[model samples]
Target: MRQLAQSGKFRRDSTLLEAAIEETNTEIQERLKKDRIDFDFDPYFAIVRRTLKALAKEMIELGVELGKSRKSNRIGERQKFVSEAQTPFEVIELGLRNAIEGLVALPLAKECVLDLERIKQDYSVEGEWCPFRVSTGNLKFIVDDDGTISISLRNPSETVVKEAKEVLIALASQVYVGN
Candidate 1:
């Protein structure tokens, strides 16, 4: 009878134990919510975002510099032919031929090869001009009489082509004209 009374006194009530467990769970959940809120508003994330923006800007600036250098080299090559030409026809013919050949020999980023035989210069009587058309894989480059170059890519539909062309133009403009 004495042992039974002592055990009863020492025994924990189930209700009290349950209440304590529930209170601890609630506190833990609240702490987790607060931690989530702190993480969402962290200044480190803002710093990272700003750093990425700055890096992108710097990359664009570098691309522009590279494009300008390439343009200058092309201009120099054309100038060399122009200086040696006795007539305007020779200037146009020789310059276009040289430029197209140079482009054909240029190594692309990938292991892609451009067929030199496919490069052609067409003279238009209406415009009194000659433009070179160069084809490589699905891409075509048309060099106009006024030296303006345009790119065309093959697609199944006109709408798709237009949409894809915009993206290609954006990327090409970055590497080519840097605009």
Candidate 2:
């Protein structure tokens, strides 16, 4: 009985040690990924694209609701005037611009700089004015007036890229529900 108890204790200790080693290895890998300065923008761009799509959907829904309300005779004339003053496309564009600006203002994106004029002048391949551009080191995120987003990443860190995605998503959620 004594020998069995001792062997059981040894096995438990070995298992614990293995688990600790595995945890440490995982931590190291995470640190390495975070520390990596060179990032490909494809993954990050996908994230942003998805976020923008969701935001656009929300904006459309809001616009439709506003339109429906305006069509009702219950709304006062002044309220109807206010609602009709801005078209749905205009509202969505303004909301998108504000959301992008808000994303840059987040703590994670403070290190990133947005240059609207530069993006318009340099990166607008469609011959249309680009509304915003965010730069982190050599990475650039350009958004055109028509809700198209493109990314240029140079020595971009995984941490910053992930944070950028998070910031955009958070802003989208906040702006979508008027919170």
What RMSD does model 2 have? 23.2
- Per-structure clash totals for the candidates: 0, 0
Model 1 residue 162 distance off true place after TM-score fit, in angstroms:
4.1
Give a tens-digit lDDT track for model 2, residues 1-120: 122222222233334333434454565566678988444445654564455554444444554555555466332222111122221111111112112221221111212223344433
How would you encode candidate 1's per-residue C-alpha lDDT over 37-77 as one tens digit per residue? Answer: 43233354345445554444444455455456555654212
Model 2, total clashes: 0
By summed lDDT, the worst window of 10 consecutive residues in model 2 runs over 86-95
Against the reference, the lDDT scores of all candidates come to: 0.34, 0.36
Best-fitting candidate, scored by lDDT = 2
Candidate 2: give the clashing pairs.
Answer: none
| Residue 19, model 1, lDDT | 38
TM-score of each: 0.18, 0.21
Q: What is the lDDT of residue 51 in candidate 1?
A: 54
